[model samples]
Target: MAATFNGRLFLKNTAYLTSTGFKVILAYSRTTNFFYAYYVLRTLTAMICEGSINCLALAYVADNVLERQRTSAFGILSGIATAAFVCGTLAARFLSTALTFQVAALVSMLAAVYMRIFLEESLPNGENLTQPILKSGQDDHCQDGDLSRKAPVLKKIPSIQDIIGLLKSRVTFSQAAVVAFFNSLAEGGMQASIMYYLKARFHFSKNHYADLMLLLGIAGMASQLVFMPLLAPHVAEEKLLAIGLLGGIADALLYSVAWSNWVPYATTIFAVFIVCVPPCLRSIASKQVGPTEQGKAQGCISGIISFANIISPLIFSPLTALFLSEDAPFHFPGFSILCIGFVTMIAFFQSVLMRGPPPVSSHKISCNSLVA
Candidate 1:
């Protein structure tokens, strides 16, 4: 069943690419450099939209799948993503000379074709499609007995306040938000600074950076496939987050000392595990809610992640400047990542202590569903 869904998604992806490719081709010969820049911006915006749309997809899936199996299903999706990233990174590293961006364009074209020819809607039939209010209020109670039915007038898009209100109710969101904040802080800084670090410390070129990313991608896939699912059910989400934070911190702490040739290779391997943890935590977080709430839940989480992305870069820039010496071989991004890990670890522990176990079911969720 999961395979079929994946095939359909591939088809959809292909179809989108094919159509976009033709449009890009037509524009390429006719457009100026400024037009190309606009095109790039447009493309990036579409990518952001696609990411938001996936949150909806996860919500839809949660609605259809039973709770017992949802975690494994999410694992399957993560595994597939892991594999794709590995293939993409390896291709980028080795075949990039031959497989330019044009190759990616071609793949997209193929996916578009497949989607147009074969894809069908996966959303379950005969379910309430209406949007509902997430806030706690008697006035928000349903008119009819069908809670699955959406509110008569849906908000076209989620508002900042609406998203914030949702976060206030979910323990999972609170914890995940903290982890995301630090992880992304570390990541955004690391990404922004790594090339500089490499140039100064090891005199790495573009090719070497590509090679490193390819290796990291390999480790990411391995951890997603072999480690995450195996470890997930055994430990609660909070513990997994702590472990992930610790691993990331460990990588950072080692970075200053790992100047040897072999250290990069070894740390890159560990980085995969560090990188893979967030999605695992996400899978578990989404699972805590009922299917009816998955879409809203994911949207709320996405908002938090976006908030973190915005905050991380700003916070890291000054810190990096303050701590990193002009001539120092190693910089502060590693230490910053370590700090983020420690902060997240503390947050996770505090969250665990404050929230005990999640309630068997929230009164709000139970009552609202009943009214709907």
Candidate 2:
């Protein structure tokens, strides 16, 4: 349904990013002082674009998934994404040296064609474009998360301003942006640096680490399917987020303590935490925005995440190199992770304490305010 659309869109875009990044790097035959930086920026730019597009996919689904089933729906969506990730990793391991970027691009293009031809639109005519659909409790044809059918068919594309206006909606957009920023900051550091740490510490080969990641992905998928659906319905979103923060902090600390190969076993539990949090973040945001706004909401929130991913590595790469040197200050990154845990705990408390926004002045605040 909607989850399928979102998952497919995200995966296809990721594949596109992979191929495009390689193409760019290959075209630049002459390596310069800025070559590595240029490569990093280009690769990240493609990833950010993919992340932004995912928001639109998320928005398509939020309106359709019932409160009771949303958690399970998200789980299924995540499962598809992880499975695709494993496949892509395996494909890259085997075919990267043999196949050119053009071949990868061709495969993606064919997949896109199949989706365009066979996949049904979830939303048609944008008939449900208006707000208040959530309030009305309509079960309209919400599968596939395509509300495009509900919208008018314009002969011309929208202007940049029109798109910006969609992103500028204050209520859900602002909060989504903030949450995305935090989530990405945490993930970029956790994922990128951990692999480096494992390789440096345990004399592990890149291939071995990839295998480890594959196993972690499988475990993560299982944990999400078992836990998220069952807990998301009963637990308050803020509390769920708080608990996840604690889990992530514990995961980071646990990694710092990984003295031997046995340490990765503990690391797997932390991987489960990483896999489970994003959906919770999405579900909370989905509940706030209506169906029509889902695209903009997902885009903006994801944009924030993209922004974080873009910046954090730039800031931390040097720190990791400088402080977490081969000999000295090995514990700085671990301490930094501990600080993230503390900051997140405080933020979660504030979120819970606030629960909802302040009461509006009837004459002052416009009724259009969605978050309020």
Best of the candidates, TM-score: 1
Per-residue lDDT value at 121 in model 1: 49
lDDT per residue for candidate 2 within 1-372, as digits (tens), equals: 122224435444554445455454434443574467557766676644555435544654555666445556766677677876777777777775436444555655676567556754454222222342121212233333332123222223334564455545445434544655766776776655666666666777877788887888787777677777777778765566656666776776676666687777656766666666677667655554444445545555666677777776765555455545765555553444444455445434544442422222211212223223
Off by over 4 Å in 1: 1-35, 38-40, 43-50, 94-99, 113-156, 288-290, 317-324, 327-372
| lDDT (CA) per prediction | 0.55, 0.55
lDDT score of model 1?
0.55
| Tens-digit lDDT track of model 1 for 232-281 | 66766456556666667677666645556556667885665575555655
